[model samples]
Target chain A: MNINHVDLAGYLTKSLDADEHRQAEEHLATCAECRAEAESLQEWTMALEAVPEAMLLDGPPDDADLLLQRTLRQIRQESSGANRRRSTLVGIAAAVVVAAAVAGGAAVGRFTSPSDAPPVAQPPTAAVSSGPTAAPGTRTATAVDATTGARITVALTPAPGWIRVKAAVAGIPQGERCLLQVVDKSGKVTLAGSWLVSEAGADDGTTLDGSALVPLDQVGSVRVVTEGGKQYTSVSL
Target chain B: MPGFRLQRRREVADEALVRSLFAEHGRAMLAYATQLTRDRAAAEDVVQEALVRAWRHPESLVNGKGSVRGWLLTVIRNIVTDQIRARNARAPEVRESPVDVPSDEDHAEQVVNAMVVVDALSQLSTEHREVLEQLYLQGCTVTEAAKALGIPPGTVKSRSFYALRALREIKSLSPAGTERSAS
Candidate 1:
């Protein structure tokens, strides 16, 4: 009977009466099409349940232009083709991982799985080792940008809501306006602080202690970039 | 590297996609972020960061099968969760506590499924969408939803049956289709 189509949706959503449910199951046992559909509906409903609570709201406030402008300005500044390429991640990771090892700062490697052994003095692809190395919460990253010939290393020590940033920055020209920023797992940049390189600092590199509002667990990397948004160096944590 | 012109074209196309996405979903994204952070300035920062992510990974938006708004909302939720986690990770007492990071697959599935369902809901005929929105989103019982919609309970049941079927035809049209829809 076409009766199945009439009640199948109710059955799929579990809104069926006891009798209706029993009858629908009886039909589903015989009808492949109804059974297949019921199976699919099960997934969709579960997905529906997983929808986050925040989607219920209508939208942003009426006055949102300033926020939009800030966002657009950020995108425009970082839109350069060289930095936009995804290779920047791998490049930053490789350089910082190597530098971390040289600085004897913290555990560093490109292999993402946390279970992979500590980075060893082997090729970049080497991953035959065991569990991750020693370090409770602190991590350090080191990087040198070829384009700008700048050297920077940042070590992060996690606090509860913030982090302690100990960074050694060098090789940038004197009086260059540079900002020290912390980036999270999703590429959100939080301005930690900024400094203008002095002649002595450029030659000897300045090591400064600072703090960032980012959490310890989310710190993906730290970077020193010019006031114009050109990154001098970025090292992954 | 691609030719200068080709790269420029891709960037422009990407920019357009981001702008449209903002035009369509920005208010909603900001609303969600503001509610989560409870601070206007911080919420703005969160929305900007989420938008940046969308701009960089437009592929996620294009390849996603759910409602684009749903996907964007999911990203906003994640960014907030990380911020909260960051705050918790450094507590002096529990500083070194083991954090059970949810697998990427877990959240991705949740986000994508919600996306699909949201998109599917939007594509539904008004009658179908109204019924589901009342029942699922508003958590109204069949009798209650029927009363609210000025329809009979039996009609609600029958409508839901067909609505579920119609939802099976979800086609995620965004990042390009977004432009047309916004117009």
Candidate 2:
């Protein structure tokens, strides 16, 4: 429904009367943007409800200064308390719960999202090709194996405990099994991802996402190698 | 030297996240907990637990999905629910209002949705926010919000529509927002 008739605010907030509510419900089912807006606005109210009257009435309780100190002290110790509550109702993150994102990445060229709420679907390989404008804090490197003339470009995005490795490998022979490895400073190798090079993948190349358990502090490089352990190419971070 | 600097930066960023969040939203969190439990000491405990959660999942803050304050508030609400359920379990006879049965699944979902909503709401104008807070948070009807907000009822109805439409555009749903830009 257009703005003229639908009271979305009233509809989402349940402020609409019975007849209005029924009409709005039918309208929302067909209207994608309105539905999305209703969902977010509904969640916003839940967030706003958490706001204590005291916060708007004035500032925090005067005693809250001590609360911050106590909080810091808790962190210094075990920093443990009530466990994580649960996932959000939208839990739309479930939509991308790609069980084998590596295969999906190689087969369809979709980058595996490191974030829980990843974008709808981003063409990450294109993003890496245009590396001059990668998101701040992301690092990119390119390496070419002179022997095989194989080329690989890697974009490394750091996360909490691991690194998101997006590697585009071109010139590898078709039907060759490959493993994506993250090499840390100490020479420790963690398998961030693995994929089979398809015909299309071997010809035009394929971009896939992998992860390395090593922290950003210790990451040394990203490498693509055969199942036989022969390195196709390696790019130092 | 760069490695050392990078490590140092990461460490400081983590600590700064917690301190900055507390500095910005600590008071409001405490107020919310106090409102929920109606016990000052217990409220402080709830806020502390929520802060700890925020610290551990610092990714939750920088993910660009939602405001950290919104996540904190949701966590606070979840913790209070669990606390009430736990207390009621200990002494079922002591509860004045019936204890809410807690579900771990519901807790997680509320936190995530609230974060997304809070993030999208951040993009709305103050007028949009006010209209939402009235009709949604206070459960005020168009007429009631008009009286409370000193605007015409027709204005309240129209404002709510526009506000919801704006929030809709800001949210990146699976289907994606319509062509309209919230800005």
Candidate 3:
């Protein structure tokens, strides 16, 4: 039998039957299109084998056996559930069961999160703000210290187990000493701390002065009060 | 045979089957799992999970026809994907601080491996690596790879063919390739 184009394609990929495969090979010997298809498949498979296995994982995890056991148990549980639910419609139910099995495997793959996401911009004021902490996902907040005529801009982020705070000054001295405090929304100071003047002013640029992951049970918002009492900044946690 | 003896025989058979699989492709499966997950720990997990998955879904192996290695890789990829999704969902947002650049000594081997593989794979198009990953490393059949990627199986096969050729050419260009090519 002559090989149809689809047959040639399928056969070339080992997705077709015996007669079709023979027809495809026979045609491929003469036909440029089919020949090219066969050649490409060979090359692709070779390149794939060339890929080093090391790129796949950072290091061997200790939890492999545990996860596998858990997954298998979960799979068995679901299989038993399905079997119990539809002991009557055996044929149709088999198809559903197979579909579910495939889906479960696929579900396991959706695990890799893209490692890179857009970086959140830190407002200069976040480093200097004297206001209560903003909500979770707030990017920037402004706080004005009327006493010192210093506008403290602050930014806060919920890092793992710690709230990160940054502040910038508008009119305050660049090297002024300050106390950074995390307080509840009710203005009750909880964790009070100090940071030396590593940076201030737009020209001074952003600096990694210091940060601590506060206990989760600590205050909700962060407030910065300059030792000189010249400027202050605060942001909600 | 007594009923209890018959049950014991079945258990022995199952154990033998598992052992045979471990002997046949354990290291290869481990390597493939490592590649897919990019974590040694996760790789081990993938291997274990794949084996468990294979045991649970023996029908997926298509009797004795399909490659056991390929089937295992598919299981590994699936498990890795699920883990990645869960990690992403629970990942906490944090300030953008520069990632601590590892000391050159820390990732030297990794860097070398990455460079070699990337150099070889980069010769092929994204489509080529992707198809190869799905078919070989990820352990999908041509049909399955095509279906997952929304391409024709023919395309997948063709892509695979060219990708391998390009890789061989690249390998030949490298010192390692020179040795293999001379063979």
Candidate 4:
């Protein structure tokens, strides 16, 4: 049966019963404008649906036993792993903690020092290696602005429990800004910080220097973000 | 494969199937429960209680084509609805903004399309916006939303009708088409 046309909005809202909806669907098949409108609505719906599913979890409260079970499972796993590698994990954790404290203190010193002195703190000159070597630590990074040729270096000392982050630019513009973030062993972000450096009375972008001492435990990875809106991220654990 | 088969077999009289069902659908059900309750912590508790309840009555689900997951979603929904009703005197607050598509990675064309819809929706009255949001974003049926709002289901249906029509017309017409419809 041929049915009279309803406006496109009624169809999208799904207010019509089965028969009316079927009629609208039939009309849409032949009507170009309605068909285009329907397609656009569908496209909009699809795009909205692509929003992170995490958004739906916004208001709903988690059920109690489910939360308990999940929590218990996570705890059991962590405990078992901890038991298996208690000694080594403890040593590493302590080292990182110590590194953080010393590095934090050294950072205060480096930043607070008289601006006239040639920033005595050296950029970290550490090397990257596998499995928490007997030798302390290393820093590595690449500059995002390659034409600007910027680089950030990180250095670590396990016993002293400090990590140093330093940046240098060669053949690029001066007064560039840099920011840092550290990702820890368990994949948690431990720190996010930034600073800018400029050579003394030099207009050339060739040389920039700034440094921070981050504790080794908090030094899983260091990221450098430049003022020209470039990000250089790296990880070590 | 063995676990799937065992969960499928209602005739086996096996105790382990209960645990298997719980493991498979537990997290998803918890997510649904949270949406229904709009409280993450409470939803988790509801899911856990529902699963434990199901575990005690595994035979209730025998000869069912629907996996244990569907049953959990239903149970969680009912429980949350009941809770909301029991606290009916209180206003519903703590609404999370509706989830929208990520702004990142959208091409210029998609962005323009989205802006069209967004601009039209923005022109809607708060009443229209709230009803549409509840229905589309929160996935609430008109009846459910009416009960929550202490309004008639017909009101929700009509409001949704006008709101969507206005949105469609706005999309079709030029920016000059700001005239409100009589519908």
Chain A TM-score values, per prediction: 0.46, 0.44, 0.31, 0.28
Q: Which stretches of candidate 3 lie above 4 Å from their native place?
A: A1-12, A26-55, A62-237, B1-119, B122-124, B152-155, B158-176, B179-183
Question: Which run of 10 residues does model 2 chain A get worst, by summed lDDT?
Answer: A89-98
How big is the positional error of residue B124 in model 2, measured in Å on the Cα after superposition?
Answer: 3.7
Model 4 per-residue lDDT tens digits across residues A1-237: 111254455565566678988988888889877787677565544433332232211112223344645644543354344443321211000000001111221110000111231222211111111112112233322222222222332333333544444433222223556555655545554334555545521122222233334455444455555656575424232
Estimate TM-scores for all models: 0.39, 0.37, 0.29, 0.26
Per-residue alpha-carbon lDDT of candidate 2 for residues A53-92, written as tens digits (9 for 90 to 100): 3332112346577887787777645422331232111111
Please compute DockQ, using alpha carbons, for every candidate against the native two-chain complex.
0.10, 0.13, 0.06, 0.03
Q: What is the lDDT of every predicted structure here?
A: 0.57, 0.55, 0.43, 0.40
* Best of the two (1, 4) by lDDT: 1
Candidate 2 is scored at a TM of 0.37
Least accurate 10 contiguous residues by lDDT in model 3 chain A: A92-101
- Cα RMSD, each candidate: 21.8, 17.9, 25.4, 24.6
Write candidate 3's Cα lDDT for B1-183 as tens digits: 343332332222223233334433454456655655556776666666676555444444433322334445445555655665454444445432223222221232222233244335534455665665666655678878888767887788767656665665655433443211111
Weakest 10 consecutive residues of candidate 3 chain B by summed lDDT = B96-105
Local error of candidate 3 at residue B5 (angstroms)? 66
Candidate 3 lDDT at A30 equals 84
Where model 1 places Cα greater than 4 Å from the true spot, the runs are: A1-6, A22-32, A53-57, A61-237, B1-27, B30-46, B52-102, B171-183
